[model samples]
Target: MPASLTIQLVNQSTSENVYAYITGLAIQHGMARVFLKADGTSLYFPGPPPAGKILQPLTENCAIPLGPPGNTVTATIPQMAGGRIWFSVDDKLTFLRNPGGPGGGAALVEPSVLNPSDPNADVDFAFCEFTLNNDQLFANISYVDFVPRLPIALTLQTHGGAVQHVSGMPPDGLDKPQTVLRINTQSAHGTLKGTVPAASPNQLVIGGEAFARPTTADILGCNSGPFATGGGGGASAVRNAIIPRLAAAFQRGCVAAADVSEHPSHPETFYRAGGPANHYARIVHECNLDGKGYAFAYDDVQPDGGEDQSGKVNAGDPRVLVVAVGGGGAPVRITSTFTFGNTSMIKLAEVA
Candidate 1:
């Protein structure tokens, strides 16, 4: 049986947010081509903004060229069978495959053609072109494998620097962790400086049981849930172990987070003001450490709200606090402090 493939526009800021596009038939084996009409269409997918909106294609046929500066655009493509496939945008190129079922997969390509390239290539596996915008542009191809059931891995190459691996684990050796892999440029040439230049990294070996040495998940497990009950810190623990390995390998900051909750509107339950159950809050602050700085707290309670039955002095409802501090040396420290009811959890460790 041939593989089933479907391609739809995943992101576009110019159209109504709807999945009214096309649900192409299952892709069977060989190469199945799907075209996107850039003449005004929007594609939707699961998740939040930037990561969700799968943009429509600019052309109804194969091959599209995005003139000068490559801008932001998103599109979604579904794969049925498990195998290797390649993708290219403008002059940038990469490959993807489905190793365990369907979902996100790893990227395989060199660093040179990861982004929009100057001198574009004609014969690409999949082609797309769009204008460059102030917003960050992204494109991805996923592989699905049913045999051993594993998470999809994405391998990305940024400019002429180094290949940085970013994806949830089950791909890299860890078991089901969300982590962000950051790669800063060590050296560059011409206009590639500062920006994540176009290049494709190599293929990622997933689910081989070989313990590929330094492995990390994008988001840790602990603080990822909603209720303030059992196992809220497991994710952070895994992140602490992986950060040092990646930082030493790439020589830059590789930040990762897990179960850490966002701020809350209501202090008592830490729920969003008018948001849904999963709504998150944000708080930013700067701390001046005196070399012997031990501990500090940020007041979360509001003044207007009166005290409860405890009479312990009412301030405001306190929930979760994500702290980010810079300026130390060697192993930098970024911690998350969560206060639920009378209980508190503090995580002070290296970047994941």
Candidate 2:
């Protein structure tokens, strides 16, 4: 590759004088080619230096007027292909004169160093991000590694509360709301887990329909209860009985008994007593079977101490639940403070 050099002349004696000195330096260095720009203007070199000799100006005492009233000339030398040389004006008094001798002007000569009285010869640099890899194969691999070529999969799990559209609303009342999903990898490799809430009923409304009508068995599905009832009867009875039973199940230590009325509008009587007043119902859920895992629970009952009526999990409520893959690598567990919701859902491979 041919070498090139760049020199910035701040207040050189004269643009011509500065050009003459720079040309001499380039010839002395035996550079393949030389390019000089002063105040954005190009300088021309008439001819190449003789065999091994450099060309220097005849006059030694050349004075470049100081810039403005106080400013002096400054020069900056940037990296060049073959070698490096920089010149600047300092004190504005010292001068370079032709050294008379046999090979006089033809003799190989060292370029005069110009020191400027001013300190404005600033060297600017453009920075860019780059990677240095010793192995050629590994170098290419590094470039492709961080470029997120393949999509990422994330799994979310819910616990403690039933997935409903909103408090007091049926799971099928509204469309599913968007939830935040994040995957945080701390080390090279490790299990990932997080929790999503199940307070919104929309979570259970699959394809615009409820997964199943409220039934004793289905309601108990949220919890691991052997005594849970079975689903049967009209829509109203099924809906009324199933939801309370699901709530009752989450109310741990409580036994639920129902009385079915023949009335089509009000079909069932759900009665339960147990568990903490605030810990009424829960729904456990999981998603993202690919690899990244998250789990969370929702609570249907509000704590007695707070005036807030929202059934969503409170910031520090003990009833707020969590689920994660077991050490044995078995299916994740959906734990609850009381009973689980019948309308829990698991999103599969949703995050990317």
Candidate 3:
């Protein structure tokens, strides 16, 4: 009779061995094991091992010592892969077989080409490449296993996480609209894994887990939704592209027209206008590209002694009031007083 077991990795990868015979070496506690690699290589404890350890191997074709024959014990030769009996060596067996762990301790194998001694590669074991230690293979560096998968047949299948379909001629001047997408899990492990397909503006990837850190741009996108924040009064850019008028409306001034007290050098303001006072001012109709209805600060008259005790006359801020926007019902007003650099200019010129 023979015994067998399977080794599965933490990342959900698997490999199986139907026959594994106990090493005849006198290992302490009967813990030493010898199994054959997928490539027909062998791993086993060499020499007079510590006494007590016993592990059974499955072999349908090999002869075993049914009864203890003399002091020189003989272990069974498991099913062969490369026409050679397999054996285990040190440095290649660092894993502890916890028969108590989930999956019945059969879920894992130690010192495996799939699992490197250094845990640093735990994140990439599923897709990295490593070569197996054959009978002729000598030491140095660990191995990363990568099994190959078969070609997937193309067909019509709808899936979630759908990327937006892009359309247009790419810089390469090629217009390619990708309609058919093949989604599948990585069949093998190693340097080769997921693919992005040919480079095309419309080439869209479908599935598989791609390990990547998320960026702020990916998480907090522009306010494209209804619950997004409104934009105005910033050194940056306008938040909304749909309502330029609405954004400008929230902007100070440009409400109604008022007395100009007009001077060529001084910027014009609707004395009763609502925006902050500044040295410069301009009115943008936005709707007109002709630069129509544009106005700016040309000159100004600072108050006598700069400050008036009346506070009502703070050397600036002309009492001459006027309408900012005319003919559109209630006008929006703004102060026409010109300060040295307090210009809160608004842009209606962007209105199209």
Least accurate stretch of 10 residues (summed lDDT) in model 3?
Answer: 148-157
| Number of clashing pairs per prediction, in order | 66, 41, 53
Top-scoring candidate (TM-score): 1
CA lDDT, every prediction?
A: 0.26, 0.27, 0.24
> What lDDT would candidate 1 get against the real structure?
0.26
What lDDT does candidate 2 reach at residue 62?
27
Q: Which is the leading candidate under lDDT?
A: 2
TM-score of 1: 0.19
TM-score of structure candidate 3: 0.16
Q: Worst 10-residue stretch by lDDT in candidate 2?
A: 123-132
lDDT of 1 by residue, 1-352 (tens): 1122232233221223222122121233122222222322322221112333332122223222332332333444333222222233323322121222122321212222234451222322221222111232233333221111122234445456766554422422222232322222222311111111125122121111111222122212112221012336532333332222222221111112233121111233322233212111211111322221211111222112423211122347855444445665324343676878898876667653
lDDT score, candidate 2:
0.27
Judge candidate 3 at residue 182 and give its lDDT. 25
lDDT of 3 by residue, 75-94 (tens): 32332221222112111122
TM-score of each: 0.19, 0.16, 0.16
Per-residue accuracy of model 2 over 1-352 as CA lDDT, tens digit each: 1122222223212322222123223333333233233432243223334455434432322232335422334433222232222233333222222234222332323322122242222211111111111221000112121211111111212243533221121221112222321112222322122223366542333212233323233333443232233546433333333333334323321221223211111111212232122222222111323322212121232222323222233465453244435443344443433434865454322122
